[model samples]
Target: MHQLSRRGLFTVAGVAALGSTGALLGASPANAAVPDSPRFDLSGAGDNPVAKKSLHANWVMQSFAYDNVHQHLYFAQVNTENSDRANAGDLWITKTDTEGNELGSMALHNFGHGVSIAVEPYDGSVYLWTEWMSSSSGFGTRIGRFAFADGTVLEKTSSAVQDRTPSIGDTMINPQPAIDPSTGRLLVRYKTGEDQPRIVAFDLADARAGRLATQHRLAERALPSRGAWGAANPFQGFTAYGRYAYLLEGRAGGPSYISVVDLNGTGQSTVVDRWETTAGQSLPGREPQGMAVWMHPTGPRLAFGFHSNTGGVRQASVFVKTQFV
Candidate 1:
């Protein structure tokens, strides 16, 4: 089975074929729950199908994460286009057995826009980041707290206090969220500035207390490319390993490199080492969209997933055991 791309997982056209937009958001009436079974073994290698055989739906899956506590994997979808009175598809959370069999599932409210997911142990609870449509400025983005188990957002409202927009041509991409275990605060660094665009971090607690503190920002020289299309990693896609953060930035035309930041202090980011995704070629096709990065459970190895343009079809890509050195 072919892997799905980050953006392709929720195409406007794809949602229409899936039935009602509500279905796409995970709004299904209760029914007999499917028993849990180990469906896919991550330790091994192969495709991990998000949906079941009976539901063979071509959902363009964007967000992906596994809850260590509940042992559940979560991902979300949105409308291919605005229809069915739903602007975006709903967020879906599924619990699977060790064999990856569908055990039970639940759907959250419609975001009206796409949503991103990231999980981290914080203050005896899990931290998450989601983007929901905001009417504050008539258009804005919300990044707040959510309950890990049932996907209930603890942040009550979509406040526009810290909202920032990208440039005209560039769009805000997936934000790789991480939490500082030491501080018990959620931390995130995203890029959206027009010139010398940067990745900045803040303590969720501070933002909640109305402080909105910024830890640090990535320097211009550290970026992949300085030109319009020569930007690094198309999105603010990144991964974290032991006090360090690994990020991928792609310039417009081609050339993508990784930036490593030390979180030992106020999360100061520095480009320790740099390498292109492909040695000599330019990054191919529509800016290689969404990305996921994380550290291997055992070693300094890093894990990542990216969008690949395979013959004009966007597919999800997997790169494992990427050494930190």
Candidate 2:
């Protein structure tokens, strides 16, 4: 028998089909579950048979978002592979088509750990929402907005980056941001000094117009728990749709989960959906990284991404959960 290549260990053909929407390769795990309200099935087909694609940036992907209007994708990565944010302030922004093919790339200086990014296409141009102002920990200290310029480098304090950190949550720690492409609403998650994890929402237009202070806040709620999953699990990424927020949490290799928070819920009851998924579990060094909403032709897709190492090269692989339960 021929042995599978190192990269082949990550293949999901045993769990999902390529073109079909709801097929599964094997039986559901004993503890597997979907959301109680309405969200994509945890075992929805991993749609892309060839989903693994390389990004323009050589560093591992930290976070990513989709451009529904422009059909583009923006991925964030740091300059070096060390765990201690060795090259933290040095950043790279990779531009790609929907399938992860690199279109071009740019550089950023003193930008925070690219935790999450929101792509906004408007008025014949495109702008990005991401973390900025690298702090001592190598993470961003504020939210920022700027236009995309391939092959160019921008600093955290550059005039092109508009500071968009909202004033609702803890003023100390900078918030992480994601957009609800359906309504153009932006949701940010933040916490201060070991308090409850919090989220605040605002209209992207109001945020971009410098009206965050004066404009009315759309939503403010606490994400009390990440599905009550476990203690060691790490928060990977998050994004919002119409009325729901989807959070990705997991460790490396196996056993990650998606926690669906109903922003309208009160207190600890906010975590309405807690589904454990084995999506991308087979990939080498597979670690869940990002989640976003993709406006697919059939319907909207819940896109989740993972970063893995293939032959010493960091690679990005994206899979979508189409159709809701």
Candidate 3:
């Protein structure tokens, strides 16, 4: 892995790949001319075969998180065969310096489908959420708490059925979890309907005591389509900044977007802004999935993880917006 400055991450080739529409350079219409609104920049991009046999599997990046305390970029990935229950797979956590240099990596067995990662600001502890199934009739979910020092699992919990919503036939697919830096509240979101998702906020105290606090409905516009391959769930990724929560919509080989919701005094969510990628400038064959936001030395940036397949290789591209609301 190579370390590059935020600006250097966007090479001429990357810019060309994104097209000349300059869609990523524009600001959201709802926001005023805030000095640092939100702008997209390529942080780093590459592809590698996920490790096999536990050494270095060719893993496909699924989710991302930024550790402000330690200033590290954390990514969660799952190997190809491990995505589904057909073959056993492993989940990997790759930690890199702010500049994208690999510092350390860890692999957890019998776990694949790494969906999301979040870092606790107070203690720099890492939290990862993953999904697994043993057979066509069986499914389960797990949340692993790891030490930032060595990626060792300090605590782990699992459920044969987690966050089930029978009304919509959804069972915590791609659950996005984040810890509010200001309040230390653990927020986890999962899709319950075509466009409606539920967000649950757990007090740190209650979480440590194995109890979930309460959940609320996230109000957002209807998705353009059901989803890639006709899947009903449309939400792909999520992160929290201040009192607002941002969600990414998954549209394979189509336009990309991020929905901004205001978590104000009422504790009710209102769709305040919907940012879409430029029509002709979107990633040709990629679907945006995961998102993470943190204040950088230069400014606040929004990072996204896009998944794609090229030449039989599963790839993940990390893109960032240095100036984001």
User: Would you estimate the TM-scores of all the predictions?
Assistant: 0.51, 0.82, 0.61
By TM-score, rank the candidates, best first: 2, 3, 1
When summed lDDT is taken over every stretch of 10 residues in candidate 3, the lowest stretch is 9-18
Kindly give the stretch of ten consecutive residues in candidate 2 with the minimal lDDT sum.
9-18
Q: Give the TM-score of candidate 2.
A: 0.82
Q: How many pairs in model 1 have backbone atoms within 3 A of each other, for residues 3 or more apart or on separate chains, i.e. clashes?
A: 29
Regions more than 4 Å wrong, model 3: 1-56, 82-89, 121-142, 148-175, 191-196, 205-211, 214-233, 264-274, 278-284
lDDT of 2 at 208: 79
Q: Candidate 2 regions off by >4 Å? A: 1-38, 80-86, 226-231, 271-273
Winner by lDDT: 2
RMSD values, in order shown: 14.7, 12.3, 12.5
lDDT scores in order:
0.36, 0.70, 0.48
Query: Could you tell me which residue pairs clash in candidate 3?
Result: 38-323, 38-324, 49-58, 50-57, 50-58, 50-59, 51-56, 51-57, 51-58, 52-57
Q: Model 2 clash tally?
A: 1
> Candidate 2, overall lDDT?
0.70
Clashing pairs in 2: 10-283
Residue-level lDDT of model 2, residues 28-135, one tens digit each, is: 221122123356655644675226677765576878888898778888876544434433555678999888888987777777878788888988778888888988
